[model samples]
Structures are given as C-alpha cells and as structure tokens.
Target chain A: MTLATPPVGEPRHRRGSPRGTGAFDRSRRRLYLPFVVPALVLYLAFVIGPTLAALWISFHRWDGVSDMRWNGLDNYSALFDDPTFRTALANTLIILVVAGAAIFAISFVLTMIVREMRGRSFIRSVLFFPHIVSAIVLSIVWGFIFEHNGTVNTILSTVFGTEPIPWLNADNLFLMILIGTVWISTGLYVTIILAAVDRIPRYFYEEALLAGANAYQRLRFVTLPLSWDVISVAAIFWTISSLKIFEFIYAFGGTTNDMPPPAVWNSALFVYGESFGGRSPSYLFGYASASAILMLVLFTALIVVLRRLLRRDSIEF
Target chain B: MQMRYRRRRVRAAALTLTVTLGLFGAACSADDSGGGSAQQFTYWSMWQEKEPQAKVLAKALADFEKESGIKVKVEWQGRDNVTKLLAALRTDDVPDLIDQQYFTVSNAIVKNDQFKDLSDVHDMEIPGESKTVRQVIPEKYDQFTTTANGAQFLIPYEVIGYSIWYDAKTLPDVADNPPKTWQEFADVLARSKASGRNPIALDGDIAGYAEFWTATALSRTLGPGGFYKLVSDKQASGWNNPGVRNALAAIASLAKQKYFIPGYDSSKFPAIQTKWAQNQADFLYMGSWAPTETGTLAAPGFKYRSFNFPTFGSDESLPASVIGFAVPKSADHAEAAQKFIAHFLHKERLSKISSEANNLTPRSDVEVPEQLEDVNELLQEKKLSKITDGVLGDFSDFDKKVFQPLNLQLMTGKITPDEFIDQITTGQRDFWAGHRS
Candidate 1:
C-alpha cells in the first residue's frame, strides 16, 4: 500500500514536472501510494476502527466492566421505548431544523446589512468573537443573563416595573438554550457567508441596482446564489456541530455539578448520561452505544439528503 | 540510473520513518500497565488534590506509609476517580484502593463484580485500637454500606445525608423546636410567609434537588424502602398507591402557596442555594454538603442547622449516603489496600474527616464537626434509609427519565398530583416494558 502512494503530499516537487511528459507523471504517480497509504491507515485505525467496535458493542449488554452479554437488538428496541432517548432525538432534530433555520435566516440578514455598512470587517470580527470563546464560558454567561434575578429579569423588574420572569424554568429552559445557541452560532455562519459574499465582485450588486433590483432581489439573485456553496457546507457543518453540543447544556447544572434535566437533553447528552456522566454513572455502554449508532445513521442519511437538495451548478463570474 | 536509485532510497527512508513513527505512537498509547509491589499499593481518591477531604486523606496516607514502611502511590482523580478506574479495570494498572460514594461504587463496580468483598476488613482490628473495624462503624450504617446480598464491598469513612437545612440565626424558633410532621412543616412555612420571608429556597433547575421534596415525602408515607419499591416495580403498580398521591399533593400545596423564593424555578443551581445561605430565604432541602458548598458565600452570621424531612403520617425514615474505600478484585496489593482501609477507619485517623474536611464520618466515636452536628444526630436515630431509598442508583436512567421530570412538574405546579401519578405510571410501565428482556 505504501509503495504506490501519490505525490499529493508534495505539490511543489510535482510542479516542476513537464505537463505532458510520461516520465514525470509516472514518477509523480509512484509517490502516490506511500503518501496516501499512511493517512488511510491512520483514518482506519482511529475513526473506522472504533465505529465498527461500537456497532459490535451495540448488540450486547455490557456495563463497560463485566463481560459483554449478547442481547441482539434489545438495546435498539429499548431506545425506541426510552422516553429520554426520544426526547433527546426530538431535541436534536428541533435544534437541527428550528435553530438551524433561525441561525441561517438571521445570519443572512446580518450579512446583507453588514455588507453595505461602514466598518464591515470590524463588525464581522466583533460578531465572530463569541464563536472563539469556549462553550462552557458562553453557557455560564447565558445562564447569568437569563436566570430569574439575572440581567434580563433585573432590567425588566427595575425599569418596566414587571415581575422577574422565570426564563430558565423547565417550561422555558430549552427555548432559552435554543436562542443562546442561535446567538452564539449565528456569528460564525455570518462570517462564512459574508466572506463568500465579499468574494463576489462589486459589479454584481451595481449591475443589479441599475436593473432596478430591490434589496430582496439583490439578496436572492446576487448574494445568495454567489454564496450558495458556502451556505450548503455551513448547513452540513451546523448539523454535525449541533448534535455534538453537550457542554453548553450540561453546564446549566453549574455549581451544583450535575447534569441538566433529561427534559432538555440532546443526543450527545443522552449518550454521556447513559455511559459516563451523572452522579451515578449508568455505564450502560451497550445501550448508550446503540443510541449513538442510531443517531449516527440518522444524521448520515440527513446529510446525504441535504447534499442532494443543496447541489447547485457553479456560476463563473 | 542515478536518479532512479536516489528516488528508491528516498522512498525506502520515508517508508521506514512512517513505520517507525507508527510503532512509536502505538507504544505511547499503551497505559503503564502493572500492579505495584505489595509494599507500595496505589490509591485513587474521589477528592481533588486541593479539596479539604483530599488534604485530610493525604495526611493520613502519608502517615500510613511512614508507620507501615510501605510506600503509598496516590492519585487525586476527583469525581472521575471511579470512571478512570473502570477504564483501567481490564488493564493490570487498576488502582489498589479507591473511594467514592457507596451507591456510585455499588452501581458501577460492585454490580460488575470488579470489586473485592471487604467482609474480612470488618473483622480486621483497627491500628492502635481495641475495636475491630465492625465495632467502630455503627451497624445502622449497614443500610447504606452493605449491598443487597449482604456483601460489604466498601469500608465506611464518610456519611452524607439530606435534610431541611436552615440558618439558625434566621429561624431560631424552628431551630429550637424543629417540626416533626407534615402539618407542622406547613404551619412553619405559613408563619415564615406571614413574617414576609420566602419560606423555601430551591434551585429548581436542579431536578434532583426538586425531587427531594417527593422522595422524602414518599419515604415518610410509604415507610422504609417504599419509594424505591414504588419506582422500581416491574408492573408499575406502585405508582397508584394512595401514599404516592399524598406525597405529590403535599409538595403541590407548597408550590401553589408560593412558598419558594420568587422565581425559584428559574434560578440556576447553587444560586438559590447560595441565597439560602445568605439568609435571603428561610429553608433549603439539601444534602449535608450545603454548608461547605455555600460557606464562602454565606451571610456573615449564618448559622448552619438542619432537621429531618418533616414526616408524613407516622414513618420517620432518615436518608443516609456513605463514601468510603474499596479494593478491586484484580488488585495485586489487596492485603495492603485492606490494611489502609483498616488504618483509615481508626478513630484518630477518621476524626480528621470531621475536623479538617467538615464532613460526617461513619465512625460513631469520632467527634462530629459543628457544621454536621444536626445531620450526625439525625443519622444516629433508629430508623434510617439510603438516599432516594437507592432508586437513583439502581434505576438511575428511570430516575433521570421518569421520576425527576414528572416530580419537577409537580413541584413547579405545572401539573397536579393526579397528573404526576398518571404520567409517572405510564412512564414507568413503558420503561419496564422496554427493559424486560
């Protein structure tokens, strides 16, 4: 496998090769196996290896300590009936669709506004700052902003003479989490969409304006179509990242140092809660693995569907 | 010819380097796997290195090594101690001694049969003391310390329990003569409200804390082990018990009357608990760790005091949780680990748990810390039960999915007692139906 590796590793070395010469192309091809083989080996060992192992584990009843007992399909059946897992799966989908929609909608608007605004780069940087901050820090700050006597309620009570709202109560907690997630996530997507928007030559907007294009027309025809590829990639990125969001919601149990209520759990939190998290670690490795594998299959299919829907022909400027 | 030869040599070198690096990476990933010598058993504690409990235990570990002339290797793994140990269980590198809350050990290690039965340790005489290990820790603690089949998998060290914690300076009337029944408890809340103070300070965001109201009330109504039985029934028939409805109604009344601090349902955990410590509210149903957790933020003159969960009907079962040491069955230095357990159980050594860590120890002879005096007296009473009657450990996923959410709804007045019963009944039924193999 190593012997036939490609010269994809050293483009500079291959750049000097004559374009149509068989000898140079053959030599470059000779390096292919060695370069690609190592990465393929590492990927197999790290990523594909554990994933297969998890698939195998999903069929058994293992506490992660004792010998694994084969219990074919029981864990999967149990997951379907497990209300917490259902809630988690539903929460994951809600974040993917609802929060995803809000983030893109707001980010596109922000991109359009900032594209024409003064100091656009500075505004973009200011907006992108939250993405760079740790989710733990962001969630804590969010908790402080929404707690009953928190910043929002304090202002409401003091200025508006209103009762302090229970923004973090069970009825409203997941909503607050979704809004915070959108607030933190919008900045990164906006920056991506904006960077793509900026790459479009300014003449496109000018030409559209001369043709009597309204703001929406300029956005639909000139901005979005030009940035469609980045938006598609960003959508996929958000889908995966949203599923992996455990730390932010987990930190809501702050200072008390327990997991947040199961009512608010997403798929990642469900996996952790069943396996290694919580005061009494369930260590239901087999069951947790089953849930994890189910989520992986569901999301993989969703991504495929998304790619198919978002596929667009590239426009040459 | 020269160019081809050089290229071949370069390829060979690259291949060699890749194989060498791969082998090196594989070697680095392997844990340092071995059980240490008998003279130097390893220890992993559930306390962080800087925690007061770790400090006290560190001193004891150091002293034990000096006296026994056996080196002690200790790691302060904090709350993840058991987790790390579980990951290391199949490896030869498993720690010789580890400690965590009893049920945590019970649910994780004991159930797996990875733990060594410590029944012999009960008979081992304490270092420089006449009493055996069994004599030092009271028999009453066996409710928490012993497993269902009577296997003592862990040796007792610290005792943790839950109660209605309050500031003595703020409610000296209740502190002087604490309420014993549910009606008296209601009167106390009403009187506190009449005096213009929020009667209960709860961090409702912590569903576990919120569920304490139902857990204790159910325990009082259904008698010892009643709550666990109710939640764990295979048929889910126990949820229909009149006692369960009564327990729900009692807490529902508190929610309807608005006894909790304003917006308690939305306050982040430890925030409302901190306010309770600051004497902003009158009472908090919490664990014995309340004082230590809130100590730095407490009001200047805040006096920590507690009373048992006000009884419903005639039962007076008190909830107790234990934290102590256990040895793995695979431990190479099992004898040495057992020796350390006996050494730590000595009154002189265990008293430091109270004095330095400000925690309650299982040793009846050890002088209880002032902060834990109320809790200690409560544990000493005749009737005792395990935390949440051990439901939270045995059926933890059920607790997380079924019990906590519904109980929270009941506590927040989002649902009535009847709805709580109805929802929990279906939830438990579905849980067992799916779980039955």
Candidate 2:
C-alpha cells in the first residue's frame, strides 16, 4: 500500500506543523493530500522497508527460498574462517584502491588536459566513451582481449617476441578484472570533474597564468581546489562502486562455471558461490549475508577514511 | 511547409524515445508467466519454448479447445528460472500446468514446498509411446523430486546422457577405432599429441566436466551400488578405486603432456573449441545430446562423431549409465502437469522437440528424426553411459565442491590415490552429512 506513492511534492510539508490542523489549513492539506501520500508511501515501502528487511534477514539462515532458521552470531563466526570470503574481501579492497586511484588520477589529468586544449569538447567525448559502454559488455571484450591466445597474447607474441603470458591464469585473473573495471568506470568521473570545473570563473585561471604560474602550478593552485566538491563526490562514487563491484567481476571472471583458478576467488564471488551451493555441502546463506554486512561496514569505514584524508581545501573560484 | 517539417521532426524524436523505453521495459518483463482463457489451462515450461514440441502442445490445447471449447496458454521459463520462479512462487502466481526440469522442480521441492503430486494421474497416454509411465522414469531421479518425508510427487520426464565427441579425421589417426579400454584411451591421447594435436577440448572449470571426470565415469564403470559404497557408504576411497584416481590422473597426465590444448590450466580452456573443431584435437568429452552443428565440433568442413568413455583397464567392465528426470512434490498442478509433461515427452512430441530444438530423448521407443538419428545411433550402438544412479544427489553439487579441488590436487601431484580417498572422505563427509536428505 505504501509503494503506491511517488517520491515528490508536498502536503507532507504542512502536516508536520502542529497548529495548521484547522479549517483554513485543512484546505491546503486537502489540496496537497493526493500528491504527498503516494510519494511518502513509495519511499517508505521500497527504499526504507527493504533496507530494514535486508538488515534483519542478515541474521537468519535462509537460502532465499527455504524456511529461515534463527542462528544468531553463527553467520558472523563463520566469516572469519572462510578463506574464500577473506580472499573476496581482500580483492574488494584491491579493486577499490586500484579502480579509485586510477579513476581519480585519470580524470584529474584529463580535466587538466581538456581545460588547456583547444579541442576540449572532442577530447572530452573521447575520454568519456567508456562511460557509455556497460561494464558487463566491456568485461566480455576484456576477457577475450586478455584470454590465453587472445588479443593481448597475439600482440605480445608479435611485439615482444616472447611466450604468451597467461592473462587469466590464477596469477593475473583478478588483475585483469581490475583493469576492466577501472577502464569501464573511469570516464564517468571525468564527466563529473568537467561539470564541476566548468562552474569556476575563467578569470582565476587567466590570473594564475599571468602571474607566471606553470601548468602544474596553475593546476595545483587553481583547477584542483575549485573542482574539490565534484572530485570528492566522484571519488566517493568510485570507492562505493568498487566495494559494490559484482557485475564486472561476475561477468568477466564469470558469474558461474568460469571461476578464477583455485584459491583466487574474490569476496563477492566467494560469498555468492558458497551461498548458491556451487561449493559442495554448501550452506552459508547466513554466513554470506553476514559477510555482506561486514562488507557494508568496511565500505562505510573506507568512505569515511578516504573522505577525511582527501577532504581538500575548497577554493572559492 | 517549415512548420510541418518541424512537427515531423518532433514526432520522430518522440517515437524514438517511446520505442527505446518500450524495448527496455520488455527486456525487464522477461519473467515467464503463462496466461489462460476462461476455458483454457495454462502451461509453463523450461528450455526452448520455440521448439515444435511446444508448438505441438499449443496445438493439443487448441485441439482440445476446438472439440471441448477450452483454450490453453503456455509460457517458457527463462534460463534464469531459479531466480524468476522463486519470485513468482512468493507472489503465489503458479501456472495451471508447468513443465519444469526435474532438477529445477526437485531443488525447489526439498528446499521449498511448491509442487503437487500426480501419482494417480500418471497413467495418461502420450502421443506415440506405449510403455507405462513408471518404466520410463528412474527411481533415483524420482528420489530427487521426493520430499524429505519420502513423498513421491514428481514424475520422471526425459533422460539425457553425456558422451565423448571427436572429428572423424582426428579419430582414425589416434586409434584404428574409438578406444574401449581406458589404457587405449590414454594411448589415443598420446598418439594425438604425438601427431601434433591435443586430444581433448576440456573445460576444466565447467561443473559438468568434474562429474564427467568423477561420478559419470566412476558410477557407470563401477555400477550404482558400487558408487554408493564409495560416496554414501564411504567404503570406496583413495587410489584403491582405480576409476576415480585414474580419471583424475588421466586428465592431469593429459595436461602435463600438453595433450590438452594450450593454456587449459587457466579458465580459457573451452574457448579453444574452434580449434578442436578445426582438427587441432583428437577428442572432446561432452553430452551425447550436443550435436556437431552447435557444439564444440561445430565447424565448417568438420565431420563430428562420438563414442562412450573408454574403459579403465583389462580388469574393468564399464556398463551404460544416464541422467534422468522426475516430477517434484511441490509442483502446483501435478495431475494436469503430469498429463502435459507426458504429452510433451511422448514419443511424437519428443521426436518433434529433438528435431526442432536438438534435445535428447529418454525413451528409446521414440523414433529419432533423420537429422539426429546419427546421434541416436551412436547412443544405442556404443551403449553411451549415464550418471542417474548411485552417489549422493548426482554428485551434481558434490563434483564442483569436492572432486574439483581434489582433481587439482591430483594435477599438482600432491595427493596419491590413498590420499585422494582420505581427501574425499574427510571433506565430503561434512558435505554429505549436511546435504543428504
């Protein structure tokens, strides 16, 4: 019933105020009644309700189908012992740093490149092409490119004149996935930084240039600080996206069957495999859900840490 | 004229947006939901709904509608039916009749109570077959669909078997004919490699491949009860069981000798099937149902054929085996569902489906279509095996979780046959304890 509502507009505004429940005020309530209830209900039912349900469901031993049995703390206990889950958590961390650092560094460089270029629009479009491609599809291409006897091998064999390095072997499968994830996601951050940079006054950059500030000085003093708000937001998106990275890892490394060589399964894939009975004698929905909850905690902590560390001095350009 | 042109442009843009949104919405609406008329009963099926058997089903319903004035609507379950069906069941939107894979229905039945039993209505006639329904269905497959309380709700449907496939060009070069003994099989691989070809296009990571290495071969060679002594009874373990160790070692030996295509140690193993079909390999192991046209042997100017897995040694006797289907207790429309299922896999409908959709039939009485008769002839002549009997839960889940890691151990040469048994017994006991009903 609550999901029947939309998420905007207000008689919700008036109802919160106490003294407005009278005859003249009642007309405003009546005017806004139809619009407010639906939106409020929709938010309450879908967004708020499910988050709470998922939180509650994390404690139970249910495989999404069967009866949910109470197993308090057991799920959490199992997580520390799950090597694959530990591997997954480590991989998630590696991905977050690799993808986040790459996105931030690439976008910052590209932003400066575009600001100083005459063909800025064309350059921006070229840089932003990856954002237009779905991460899953890009992973497929990445898999083929990095697969044994695939594109990278062909190139390596021809140029380097060496034996074909196994791109998707146990040693490098996760790294290959990280490259694919970063490449597919970097362009969006560039777009975000560009939008923020466009808001800054052009005079500040001109003044910095006139004062004999070199390109690097102009960047450090002017563009970087002015674009802090957008950069922080984009970086936050990156951290969270990397932590929540499932589709590309799942699609490229394979969601089912095409697993990373043994002992190399990442946390999401590990939790997913154990939960889905891909493992023998598998029964750890509660453990998986707990690991997922642990992941959320890690994500929040990392975001807070990164935000504090990178919370830059905002320039009022 | 200018105003008219502007209006046309606006209309074209609106149409484009609408079409794009429509396509997206349609994609999201890919959940399988069967619809029925006032007099009609709806049926939902897994696998290819576009096949002629499905069309025949719709026609049967149409025939009933014409005579008895009842209509029928059918829907195809998606490849993602596990996710979709759970959502549908939660909504209590089960169709009047559903032709689900016995495994899908079974997985739901034990874990979730969503099926209806139809033992009383099991005698319903199929279009062509004369055998009683009981003879056609296997008990172990029936066991899969049974409840923990030992209730028989689901009926067996079609049984499919996996086999060894090769291009005819590679086969004669490896051996005079396909090898019957496991020793000869190893020799074939060696000869293939000697002839500068890898022997098999094996996808080591594929779950079915694990079973092909472990359960299918082990059970078929050892028999149902022998497999039980090994898996359930825990009597058969280690290098003592030649089939188990030999299969794993055989695969590892192949890997070591580079008898497999290059880079198989990684996940890129199956991606080399084009080369396998290109006659770069002498043998490839897969299901008998997979024909040359669409499978790994699918290549132009390539001739595809198959034989049963080779025997282990001079002492070993390998009999035939299979993977069969059964009805689940949780199926909502068991009586009507069984009738529809019977009609669907009935000899006439089975032939139609095999012809149109390239599926294998469980019933031998059904005439094979001219196109797929070669595949059928191979199954009959060589006595190609199945994995239906013995072991716990087809080792379907067991193979991936236990046997694979153990095989990797074999590949690394870390574990001997005795150690392999210790590994399986030690690890899989916990698994079997938790999983077995």
Output the number of the DockQ-best candidate.
Answer: 1
Model 2 residue runs over 4 Å out of place are A1-37, A158-162, A202-218, A255-287, B1-39, B51-70, B111-113, B127-131, B135-154, B173-176, B204-207, B214-247, B265-270, B292-301, B313-333, B369-437
Pick out the ten consecutive residues of candidate 1 chain B with the lowest summed lDDT.
Answer: B29-38
The lDDT for every candidate, in the order shown, is 0.86, 0.59
Model 2 lDDT tens row, B1-437 = 77556655655665566566557656766644443334555555554566544565565555554654545565666343444555455444556554444444554444556555555544565545676565555353444445657665455444444557776654655334667677777777777678676777755545445445555455545654455456654333433566665655565565566676766545444566556667666666665454623454466655566666666533222223332223334444444445556655555555554555555565666665543454566545543333433232345345545566676555434565567677777656655544411
**What fraction of native interface contacts does model 2 preserve?**
0.19
Interface C-alpha RMSD after superposing true interface residues, each candidate, one decimal? 2.3, 7.8
Sorted into a CAPRI-style docking class, model 1 comes out as: medium
- TM of chain B vs. native, candidate 1: 0.95
For model 2, what TM-score does chain A reach?
A: 0.81
| DockQ of predictions, in order shown | 0.51, 0.17
